[model samples]
Target: MVKQWWAALIAASSVLAGGEWQNCFNGKNLNGWTVKVTGFETGQNPGNLFRVENGLLTVSYSDFPNNSFKDEFGHIFINRPFTNYHFKCEYRFLGDQFPGGPKWAHTNSGVMLSGQAPETMEKEQKFPTSLEFQFLAQNESGTRTTGSICTPGTYVDVNGKTIKQHVIKSRGTALPAGEWVQAEAIFKNGKVSHIINGKTVIEYSNPKFDDGTPLTYGWISLQAESHPIQFRNIQIKELD
Candidate 1:
């Protein structure tokens, strides 16, 4: 009986892990994504803000003139829009936050899901209307969760009620600065799951725009929000 039970469990797990995953970051260049920044034109990475180095897709600000951030909130968006899929990536904070960045942006970044295309954003748009899988590492003095959700120009249903708040905390794992963390998002239909280090931290259903329109599909984006961060092994598998 134990042998039969183990076989069944493996079969069920395979169903949840359906379809083959393809690499979203090519590791050599930003070939399959578009870069958008608040001040610069779309696709213009003035400071090499987004680049691949040492086999990792890095969001670096070292080239910024005068070493100033300039409030150039940026997003490197996946080339295509996805509807039902499982996306995962590993990220780690590398160094200090850029000067002149938001005070709250210390060791902060995120992955944007259900987001509008880069082409559709206004020239000065800071963030797209989407659900953000907010990533944060503990500062030198305090603790912060790593897999929370932030809604910008959107809303999600949690606990069977619609929430319009901009930020919602998740019971995600907490880690010290400079430690690599794994974050995953599973989106099927209108439901979404945020996971950190293999634990499901937050779950939301029926994600839609604040204007009452349902958001069933959209592009994925990686944030470059005034922090030096590195992401690698970004892959996505389609879900039926």
Candidate 2:
């Protein structure tokens, strides 16, 4: 009887440990999502930048100069909001660039958290006031890596080191510019752990970039910058 009890306890613990993660995007359609954006006129506008086909969430910019973000600026925020969770997604660079935009907009994409409502943004606003997990592809020399964090209204500490800067560039292996990379972010309390390709590139705590005004929770958003990017396998698991 004692042995059976112990076995049962272990099994239960294992199941609980594995049940913390949940899939946010169904890899099929934009069923559980809402979009807020100003735009041009087309089937591939900013509100429609994210699309699902063959179980992949593809972020394309081929119609940029034609349909999306041509004269309007906006963000497409996720319909749901989360506080403490583990968010994971797979992304890839499509190696397509635009003729005109900011210098960094060539291969720029990001996951915005703790962000404001998309409809509430200013007409000419550049970016939302939130914590941004910056995604960069190889510019010229392939120097950039994954797992970098850009704090718009937040900061974080790691191992007693409180970062006061805006960008915490991760020191991980450089992902190939045109390949798929697995990105993971562990959020709990006010801390974050940035993982890329199954490797932990950066860990931060107590995030607050707004001059000590810490943000505990907000919405999640994906970037539709003037570049071609693709994402899939988006899922999250709530934490206790």
Candidate 3:
């Protein structure tokens, strides 16, 4: 179960804690990012699903036919991996769901944590082995929590107990639609915490692949699961 536990831990405390913040999203282009769409080879952008517009790294669906998404999930990942760091970003749901995604993905998009390399994933793989720090937007109708955790081909532990199930809810309330919500993740001391706005929403430790390989380091990626979302201010700080 321990692929050596990544050999270390990474975390994001307060950005105010301040090391040096690297702008993962330069706000101009996807220069250092890699695209991986389901059923497509790595580095392929089948439908222009990911792009930069108006200085924001965006996930758009204008190319898909009306009511014809066909479950074409995708991700754009940083070119390299990281360990013992803090990650932060701003996101807002836009447009409508692509009509083919699961109901739970209606207002969902996320930044993947401790994810497998983009190049290693199978062409038809829906998602990589990673912990998802999901951002759920509020529809003003019912209860939903932002900054929740979802394991896709991965798993984590909480409170010193083994939690193999997927979809762990967070304490943070659902943020309003069309508004930018601040989301962050801190991987430190062998534990990880999800922060929404200014509060810690969910926390866990011991991330591992479904096959039980320890995830000590991984690439940071943004999800495009049939929903249009905007991600900006993507930054990271490696802890000393």
Leading candidate by TM-score: 1
Task: State which candidate, 2 or 3, has the greater TM-score.
Answer: 3
What local lDDT score does residue 160 receive in model 2, on the 0 to 100 scale?
83
lDDT of 2 by residue, 1-240 (tens): 111122333343333323466776877887666554444322224535567757887675554445424534335566656667788888887756654546667677878876655544555565666778778777668788667888765667878888778888888756666788888888888888888888888887887646575666666777767676778888878785
User: How far does residue 201 in candidate 2 sit from its true spot (Å)?
Assistant: 0.5
lDDT tens string, model 3, 24-67? 88888789999999888999986678988899988988875445
Flag regions of model 2 displaced more than 4 Å: 1-19, 37-47, 65-74, 209-211
| Per-prediction TM-score to the true structure, in the order listed | 0.90, 0.79, 0.89
Clashing pairs in 3: 6-216, 10-84, 10-187, 10-188, 11-85, 11-187, 11-188, 12-86, 12-186, 12-187
Clashes of each: 0, 4, 10
Best lDDT goes to which candidate?
1
Q: What is the lDDT of residue 120 in candidate 3?
A: 77
> How high a TM-score does candidate 2 get?
0.79
Provide the global lDDT of candidate 3 against the true structure: 0.83
Distance (Å) between predicted and true CA of 74, model 2? Answer: 5.2
The sequence of per-residue lDDT tens digits that candidate 1 reaches over residues 76-134 is: 99877776889999999878888889888888899999788787778898998889999
Task: Point out the higher-scoring one by lDDT: 1 or 3.
Answer: 1
